[model samples]
Target: MTQHRIRNKNLGLAELIAIALGGMVGGGIFTILGISVSMIGSLTPIAIVIGGLIAALAAYSYVKLGLYYRDEGATYSFFKKIYPNSHFSASAIGWFIIFGYISTLALYAYTFSSYAISSTDFANNIWIRKGIAIAVIGVFTLINIWSVNGMGKIEDLMVYTKLVVLTIISVVLMQHGTSSFGTFIDNMALDAEKSNIFSVLIVASLTFVAYEGFQLIINAVNEMTNPEKNIPRAIYSAISLAILIYVVISLGALFAIPTEEIIKNKEYALASGAGNVLGKLGTNLVILGAILATSSAISGTIFGASRQMSVIASDGYFPHWLAIRKNNSPQNAIVGMAVMASVLILIGGLELILEFGSITFLLVSLLMAVANFKIRDKTASSTFLTALSIVCLGIGAILILYYEFTTKWEQMMAIIILYLILAVGAWVYSKKNEMKGKSS
Candidate 1:
């Protein structure tokens, strides 16, 4: 039987929210803060709000499509079922979404390791950090392979606990920061004058990846209870909470930490700033919060994305063996995802992974918006909102691409080459599935 056949509907509203929050809040603030602050300076919080709003727009289509189809495969399955005739489209979305998850998985783990090792003498050793990153991915993979319910409970603890730690960290930073509240406002005004609107928008677009995890809620449709009500409730609530946490913490980081310090210590920027502002005690707290955040995110991503991987594999877009499950979990797919993410951690630079993940999700989410717009009547979606989501998400994706082309053309070319490789893989697999159909 398919894994969906054994659904116990054990995931409730809280667990679902934890999963979504776990996915979104993971290492997002920790990594994005430095980059966003470097670009927009004191306007980082505003850019974060814009990014969160963009994510909300993306979530609208996901929620509508999710409820309409009730498919756990989510992005790929939604597109595939909506346009069943388009095997290549299904295959391509499957490849893109899975790899997107892989990139984020690597991102979170790398961030986790960066913080985990920051307090140690081995802080500057990249190899050790990467090794630890791979090791953490292995730990979460085993947790996910163990039990869905177990993972959910752990996620609840990690996500909720981190929220508290994070809030406290932000408050403490602000209270002890060199920059006063008035100074913060003045700096923001200064940044407004210095940074172009386009630069702020580009940073906002980059932050979209930080919000990519809410749709992860839909990936748990089979495991979740009351899909009709709980899906919308859990996802919307998670996104709202994420926005609040991101804004507060980002504002704290920007206020307390010098802009140059954050920019210079991009890998563990939050902790570095905490060290200078709040000293050892505060630095430890930030590191602990970051570790928890990234750990839960890694776990949540593995739990949600592996299911999609198996579904795609079952449909012949991936190796069929990955579809095989034990104890209602796609064990092989989980292992496959872990191995791949570890490989990425070993090779992928922080910036490259960040850019790859941001671009992939923005493009994929834009596709979801387009697909939702096509079936607005059936999904009960708002015409104006959906159209606006399309326009804004399109601009979000374009802004990132434009920024890369203008400044980082080589990186853009690398991303382009990666896309070409994925497209070719999709074609090959789709062809294999087609030939299998004929042979059978």
Candidate 2:
């Protein structure tokens, strides 16, 4: 039997939960909720619930995979174990995951800037926002480099903060109710005359971004105390909690703000909704929460992305230098990912980066589900559950792609270009390493 020597001890259930929540509750919720409301009208809450259900299905599949395969690479290793001798395919999927993480980090970094400005009377200067964003990226990157555990603790706090803040806002909104519950419910009923099912599906696809971070738990299994049991528990718990929060928050926004205003000013919809109930102070609090949420996500994502890169390097698919860890942390890979994310932040703009990240994540998730099915016979799971996961993943991928083409083509194209460049670079680097190894 081949010994899998990678150490499996760093994180606990709390850490896993923090990572999951941090990854999912980023700036997207504050920014995308309004846009989703605009697209789906009064059905925003239901749409969020639907998105959560889909994410939950994916989360279930990931739990099984995490339990069966206790590897550091998570998605890549799971897929490779399922389809042996498919290193190229595994690495391809790995790159997709890496791209998603990096893109998300960039998006959140940019959002940090926007939220910072809104939270304070910061003159609303563009250069000031950019400077603040870069500074935030720099500070978090240092934190990630210094200690993963510290990053985990910070993430946990942010998760709780967001949940509490959103809950308070929801309660306040309910206290001063708008348009009776019956009206809201009636509005949820889709009108065939006004919008087709396809349109609703497209809009629903965008809402899925709010649930993206649920899977980050699977990647953190290597750090978990009792991964086999705790991993599944954390995935289910975190995902359920996120769903509840997302649904309540989306409903609160719809109830507080007019649909027309949400559509017209989609960017600060959460702030607008909070302002309706808590006045300007509520808006400021929401912006602060948004900043915390985005920053927490950036920290978690950078940590995870670096670990994935370390795994890829260890496999000899990339340079060995990237695999080196200082004080048990992949400092080089962390800095590398941070630098790349910073460049992306500067070049692509937040909206474009977010769209690209969402699509990449969707593709990787679908691949993981397919990989789950391929390994079902070999693993310790029922065929029915495995098949269900695959089906759900397929549906999700279709929805994401449909939404991208209809509404996010330019961003998708930008992502495609980035992937192409990464592919060529990875290949060239691999060849150079191979030659050096042969000579040595």
Q: Rate the local accuracy (lDDT) of all candidates.
A: 0.89, 0.74
Model 2 Cα lDDT, one tens digit per residue, 1-440: 01221353657788888888888888877677666765667766666776777777777667778787776677777876787655556666766777778888888888888877775677477778777777888998898876667777887788788788877877676557576677777777644346666666655566677778776776665566777778888878887898888777777777777787777767687688778777998888877777778877877777777887888877776667888987667788888888888887667476766777777776677777777776666566667766775676677678777666767687677767878977776666556555766798
Q: Which candidate achieves the best TM-score against the true structure?
A: 1
Q: Write the per-residue lDDT of candidate 1 for residues 309-400, one digit (tens) a residue.
A: 99999999999999999867899999999999999887767677677777889999999999999999999999999999999999998998
Best by lDDT: 1
Error of 2 at 131 (Å): 1.9
TM-score against truth, every candidate: 0.96, 0.91
Steric clash pairs (candidate 2): 11-223
What is the number of backbone collisions in each predicted candidate, taken in the order shown? 0, 1
